[model samples]
Target: MHRIFEFDDIIYAVLQHVKSSGTDLVNVAMTCSRLADSALNILWAEQSSLAPLIMCLPQDTWEVTENELGHIVHFSRDPTPIEWERLRKNASRVRRLVGPHGFTDVLKLPRGESFIPDLDVSGYVLQRLFAWSRPATLFPNLCELHFDAVFSLLECSSKYWLLRKFISLGLQALRFDVIDIPTHEAEQLLATLPAEAHGLRQLTVSADDGTMALTVPPSLGKLPKLIGLAIFGIDVCLTRQTIANIQQAWCLQSLKLKLCGTSCDAGGIPLELPSLKTLHLSDGSLPQCTHFLRQVTTPKLSHIDIRYRGSASPAEMTAFIESLSTSCQTGGYLERVHVIDESKIPDPLLIIPLSSEIFRPLFKFNRLSSVKFVGVGNFNLDDGFLYDVPDAWPSIRELKLTSWKRRAIDSVTFTAMMSLASRCRSLQTLHLTVDATQSTIIPRAPDGTEKLWPTQTALRNLHLGYSQVSEVARIPYFLAEVFPTLFDFKWYDYYCGHYDDPDIAMISALSALNDALQELWALRKSAGDHDLDERWEKDSDDSWT
Candidate 1:
């Protein structure tokens, strides 16, 4: 009796369900001679998932023993040479392999001996696989690689040599996270690399403390195509010097500096960069920042973003911005300054006075287009001098104000915003944050009603900072009443309570707002189904572009 088989349909179904490695197809083909012949030339072993299948085999196949299997079952639990070879043949598709456990303990080879037995186990497995599959040439298609920074590799002579050989491949991107290296060795490795390797267009060097400084090679600055440079943990002074050392890097356009030591002295260094367009400075100390400003002279500079620790007082922050504006006037064409936060330090006495002085000069710059203040509190706008801020920043296109303290902003206090809207007619975007904690201090609008923010003629983007998720639920009404032309809106929960503990209440509020938006979107999409009113959908649809 002949059994019927749906060969084409079976093949299609097999391909559809072959989500794991091709190991399943190989096993199925082994069940029958006919199946094996049919599956020939399937190229199932070329599957990308093959390496994981091979790596997991040692954990599942509990049949290899050290004494019984000799060399064949070296990695297997219960030495079975024939079975090992069968598994090896099926698993050899894996060109590159990673071990679950890294090499440790130096593989303790006997003195003067060429090889250690367990070390040979790893090499033999890889060698047999490579020999059977001819994977050496296959690795050219591979461009990314990852490896655990094994501790033993640093001290083990054999492993260290092998590591060097393994990593010298033509890799485009390599990320070695938290791989502790001796300071001297790390320095040597970086110092010895030839700068002419044209393939490495982007390089990231990161370390956490004790690892030696991963100095930027002077040769790297000379690379014709290098455009991005990110350096972390170097001394602030050293970082400025290194950047100055590569001053003529015309290709360099993006820079990110997270300096660790004392801020560099700007008195001696002439801040200068001719081609740089983007600069990110994360310096915690403001006094050190003056030096940084003195060194930057980007004629085409369009963006400057700052992130520093919370130690700068409002006064010092004012100085920092002044120095930045001064830098642009001297050597750069600074167009936009985005301070992620103004108060690098929490000293309030410095913040209030600094805000007054900075706002006065800040409003005078026509080249400055946008300013974003994160975690900035203090300065009473009710004061008559504060009313001139909007006019002072005539060219200001976007303004973001985030509050760390709760204070009442009365319509009477909105003279600055009104002045900005009326005088600095160039203002197109405004982001405002109001801390609800000052509810008790800031007198409520009459009759228990919420007051709408002052209206602006050219407002397009508006962000509201609310104290709670519940407060955000009132935004649609808030926007409709005060900002009819608003094209974009975002709300952030500025958690203002003292507990500082994990507060799920804030998370729940955010989740609820997210759910509300998702539901609104779903409703808008379904409006056409029943010929229900679609005006809301059309009205809410924004087409600013």
Candidate 2:
């Protein structure tokens, strides 16, 4: 090694070999002064990780070290109390410090245990490094500070005081996660946030309970630099005027609302968001939310993700989607729309329009590139959402359908899917999920008869439950057609017709899908006309116990 280092060419070759073998150069240098000095020179070129190490070093050593040498150390682990004391002494050099888990007392709170805490892991490091002068740790010069225990602050304790301290740090981004909060307490907390912290650019507040309602303080609307805001579990009976008041915020750009019920009273006046770009609403009755959206006139909006939870009629659901689509086109603001739900409500009212006629007459999502329908079961499309697809969605290239539960997919749903594919002229990829062992079959057109899809339509990707083939096989033979463009196929619990044990079949199907995806990817770059034969072989191989 020493001889090789005599020449640049040989040294480069050795370094390349070591790098390729994944050996750490630092460990090698630790063996000798020559290599250590060389490695130190290269490593010291980037001084970002130096502060924490200097803060943790022995007090005597820190006092003797030159200012330039402060960036040479790295902490072996999260700060110990001694290291924290050292940091407190040399607080000015402390710019960033990240701590190990449970650095603060916030973890004792119920919300922290059940949900999330606001303690910024890095703040621990900062605290230790600047322990000598805690005030110097303030974020006037700091750019990013993450505290995970903010959600636990509602409780009365030192943690609450810590939260207040964090807020005063002049952070640009804040994330508060928790499971639940009393409505009145949440309102008071929001109202208590010092108005001067208006410099906040991003805010994310989440709760896990779907049934609990959130009562956000109207003072939230007064934030000046608030660009992004996400609020979950906000199903209170908010007046339409209140929504308008919040929308009137000049700088808000991204908004996410998780509603538990259908009670939004956006006054009859149209709510307008001129600067908003992205919107996500989850857990609500589609009909009620649609009416609420009609009052929203956001011309600059570009993305929307809507998730329905309550039971509503299919017609109402379709009309809701249609109305939202029309609003997007008229404002020329929509680029993507995603609908997700976990409810398996079987009211023909909810399913019919979404699957069949509702999306037919409307212009295809011209500006939209992605669309997702998740957790759809007992879905019907005979009336509207399932009508023959429209051509307006020329820009749509990817589609995803995700459903849970075994009975979410049915024969009618699959047949309607074929109709949707026939209309997506520019569609490049599609994801279809069937929950159980059934698959729908679209029969071949009669001989000499013209049909929209005379043969099976091509899909780039397909995901089905193990029972998809068995269900589709029940149909006439002429209806069987492989996806011509299929490159990837996944099955969850895919089973052969003869599996004696249902549980085993599910496990087998899951295994087969994983294996198939891997094998296909391995062969993706291979040149071959053996696509059909290869797929069949792969599927057959997966069925083996």
Candidate 3:
């Protein structure tokens, strides 16, 4: 251990690859005060409730007793000057909190921010403590405050005053986690946000689903540093004026919201977002999505993740796609597009088979690398679409088009899928549903000689989701012919519920495909192939987990 200080460069090099956790980390932390302090500081930072910290005051300062429901904490008496100073010093170190739990109820504060979460801290005790300091001791330098209460703050309530007190200019993030505020009150709180915290960067207001209609206050857009915003609500949340104001936000980059039901007003000024890059919308109808796409022009946009919660006609889908194409400037900058249909229940209106024509608008974004569409499947993908994809997205890496429930929509075939292998040379992960009912077909030349089919050597994973596959015995060879370097071949069964129970047929199919790969890997391994192990260490996977 003394050698750690002797050679600092050697220690740095050794520490880079060392994996330490649990008792190993605890034992190491116990060796020094600095490491122990850091570990305690991290644990105390995310403490969730103030109950634990409040107890650290002088022994007689707070009394712990029991009630009908649970234990409670109340001030025994006023803290003396020295005791108060001791409490203040320790409490000030808390930078962020994610709770209020049962603390507010015991404090007799239905709306008071003073109410501690998950603990029965007395109301009178908090009132006296906060009253002692104008800015409030608990809130002086809090960068983040997350409330778990279903609180509604009326103007005269302590919750409102405490909320205002907590909203200092230094605060960076705030979240309303537990309660879904009514439209008027939500607007009131949002309206007050910018005035208090001009440096606020991220804001999240969550509800169960789209049941609550939350609107963005125009004042929210005035925050100079506000970059990320996610609100779970219906279409009414994004008013025309709100959308217009959002376009003018040069600092804002990512926005996530759900759209559904009716909004009396739907149009927004055609405003441009110069720095906007990632936009995610879910529970949105096709018309509303098309409307949303028409409202904003984001030249720097790279990723668009959207979900159709219910139904849409082919024309509506096409119109939405067209609007999306127009909204994003397609000088080959767009990188990812994920379109999903979350309607688990089947609907006659939702039985719209997806055609390549609906996606043709995206051809302009030639640099698109990752494209995914799930459960919007009733695939009618044509040869032209597959043939043109390599030309359209030459550098494509991941393409997933899958539908598990509706096996009735499979039209794409193996021959058509093979066309992509020649051009999309860098393709790695593919999730496509193809008509594999005729699984015995072999690739042959025009003159009838046995021809070698084009194989994608870079392809690692092939996910055939509920696609028809007969003659299972011969399918492995067929897969090996298409993807020579494939590491995982999944046919008919998709990987969704991999842990709940084992499927016998899925296991059999996986084993057969793996056997086919063993022959393919035997030659590569003899030549020193360690691709699989090395590929797992991606640049983004920096943490141990």
Number of the top lDDT candidate: 3
lDDT of 1 by residue, 73-141 (tens): 234444244544554433433232333232222122233755323322334344344444433243443
TM-score against native, each model: 0.55, 0.59, 0.74
Provide the overall lDDT of each model, using Cα atoms, as 2-decimal numbers: 0.49, 0.51, 0.65
Clash totals for all candidate models: 23, 49, 4
Q: Give the per-residue lDDT of model 3 (tens digit) for 315-361.
A: 87788888888899655668998887777684633456778888888
Candidate 1 least-lDDT 10 residues: 434-443
Which candidate, 2 or 3, would have the higher lDDT against the true structure? 3
- Evaluate residue 179 in candidate 2 and report its C-alpha lDDT on the 0 to 100 scale: 48
Model 1 has an lDDT value of 0.49
User: For candidate 2, what is the TM-score?
Assistant: 0.59
lDDT by residue (tens digit), candidate 2, 1-545 = 46656665554455443332212545545766545544432322212232323534554433221233221222345445654564333333332222222122211113333622222223343344444444324333433334343122223333333445556436566665444445555455567653746677777666646656654556777777888888776653663644655674678899887776646564575767778888887767776568667767777778887777655556776777766765554534577777766465544333332454554533444566777766544433341343433345656666765444433334345455565565565565566543223554444576955443534354555555432333332222222333345554555553323456455545544654565455555454343535656665555422110
